[model samples]
Target: MSVIFTRRSVRSYLPKPVEDDKIERILRAGFQAPSAHNKQPWEFLLVSDREDLKAIAGMSPWAGMVEKAPLAIACCADTERSKFDDSEGAWWVQDLSAATENILLQIEEEGLGGVWLGWYPDMERVKIFSARFALPSHIVPVSMIALGYPAHPHRPADRYDASRVHYGRWGVSWEESRSGA
Candidate 1:
């Protein structure tokens, strides 16, 4: 619960770098996420260089933090291993998302901050990353997250939206369910 309340998508971070031990823990937590048939098809790519971070930040709007954050982790999925029926593929993106969330939680627990930046839909960036990292053709880069000690204290986020909840039908109110309280 503490982690739940504290885990915020920090877009800015201090210039100091994160400890190597914490990176190990974050990777461990990411791998601990359950995968379909235990495929565990995720690969982590850590970037700590200023120049490389700047190049990547140029690719995505929400990724400017990559330039400032001390470290960035690329969550890539080995799409080839996502297959279950011995011949083809499955939903590896879902599996990778699970791992990403695990990393986010671990980030907060370890006193670090982060933001999940989307990249899966951007084909151009993928190509750039593929060549830059010398990744296998079968591997697909899904997302990147910036990590570091936060410069600001993040407040708990309320994901709640009362009007969006319905009792049964499209317009039916869930408010009645809480009646007689």
Candidate 2:
């Protein structure tokens, strides 16, 4: 719970490289995420090369931090492993998102800093990343996580909002429901 509350999107990182064991643990956490209909469609691409990282940083305006981070993991979805095959069959997106969140949480637990960079739905970024990594047509890049030792400490903010939480219905607040109003 501390890890969940303390996790923050870290954009700045130190120059030191992250250890391989930490990387493995992070990946393992991603693999442990729950999937839709037990269809785990996630695949990871590790990019540590300075040149490649710079290239990735250029792929999106929000991804400039990748250029400085020692490691970046591209979380992808294997379309062939998806549960369905129609235009509305985007459950893989949710699965990949869960995996990405798990990875970020594990990064925080590992005492490292990390940020999630969106890639899917942006056709230009997706195409560039696919071509750069030579990913198969079935493999869709979902998110990129840039991680390493933190350049500075990140303090967590309490984001809990009771107003945003409904009890049994959309308009029924928790207090209203509790009081049987």
Candidate 3:
């Protein structure tokens, strides 16, 4: 829980390579995430070469410092298994979202830092990453997670607000229920 709470968006990283064992642990955690209908359509592509990372960074300037990170994993989704009522549908995005969250949390737990670079939300990134990797038509590039040892520590944030929690219905905050209201 401390890892989940302290997890922050780390945009920069130290020049240290992440150990394969730690990466395995993180990927294992991701694979453990629940998927709708047990249709696990996620595939991870690990990229560790500095030149490859540089190419990725060049494709997306927002990921400039990500080139310095020693490891990155491209989250790809297989559209074949995901169906909306027995037809080719787009339900894979939600399933992939759950998986992505698991990966992010796992990275934090593994004492590594990472940032989820959006690829699905933006068409530009989709084209860029897909063309770079030569992704198949059925596979969608969801995002790239830049991972490495943290160059700086993340300060804990108090973003949770008690007032934001509503019980049962709109605006009847959870705080009201604890007092038997």
Candidate 4:
């Protein structure tokens, strides 16, 4: 819970490199994520090369931070291992989402910071990643996470809202129950 509340999407990073052990722990957390039918249809590609990072940063407008990050992990989906056929119908996206979240939480635990850069639904970006990384046809790039020592301080946000909570029925507000109405 502490990790969940403290996790922040850190964009700016220091030049210091991340420890190999921390990276391993983050990947381990990602692998532990739940998947549909226990298919575990995910493959992680770790990028530490300066040239490769710069090239990948060019893949998306929102991923410019990848150039500065000490490490970048390409979160990919293995369609061959997944149960669904086409990329559109595959449950791999949900599985990968859970994995990504777990990775972020673990990053927070490691005292590092990172941001999730989306790519999967965008075919052009996916094609670029595949071509650049020489990913096999069975693997589809889903997201890229840029990680490093944070240049900024951690600030957690509390997003809970009672108004959004419903008791049982669709419109039965939690407020009504609390007020004994």
Best of the two (3, 4) by lDDT: 4
lDDT at 88 for candidate 1? 61
Task: Enumerate clash totals for all models, in the order shown.
Answer: 0, 0, 0, 0
Q: Residue 22, candidate 3: how far off, in angstroms? A: 0.8
Q: Candidate 2: what lDDT? A: 0.95
* Model 3 lDDT per residue over 126-157, tens place: 88788878888888988788988999988768
Off by over 4 Å in 3: 84-89
Candidate 4's C-alpha runs over 4 A off are 84-88
Report the backbone clash tally of model 1.
Answer: 0
Model number with the top lDDT: 2
Could you give candidate 2's per-residue lDDT for residues 119-176 as a string of tens digits?
Answer: 9989899999999999999899999999999999999999998788898779779976
The best candidate by TM-score is 2
Predictions ranked by lDDT, top down? 2, 4, 1, 3
Ordered by TM-score, highest first, the candidates read 2, 4, 3, 1
Model 4 CA lDDT for position 71: 94
Q: What clash count does candidate 3 reach?
A: 0
Better of 2 and 4 by lDDT: 2
Q: Which 10-residue span in candidate 1 carries the lowest summed lDDT?
A: 83-92
Predicted candidate 1 versus true structure: per-residue lDDT over 77-106, tens digit per residue: 998788787646547788899999999999
User: What value does the lDDT take at residue 33 in candidate 2?
Assistant: 97
lDDT of 4 by residue, 1-181 (tens): 7999999899999999999899999999999999988889999999999999999899999999999889999999999888744345679999999999999999999999999999999999999999999999889988889999999998899999988899988879989898998
- In candidate 1, position 138 carries an lDDT of 83
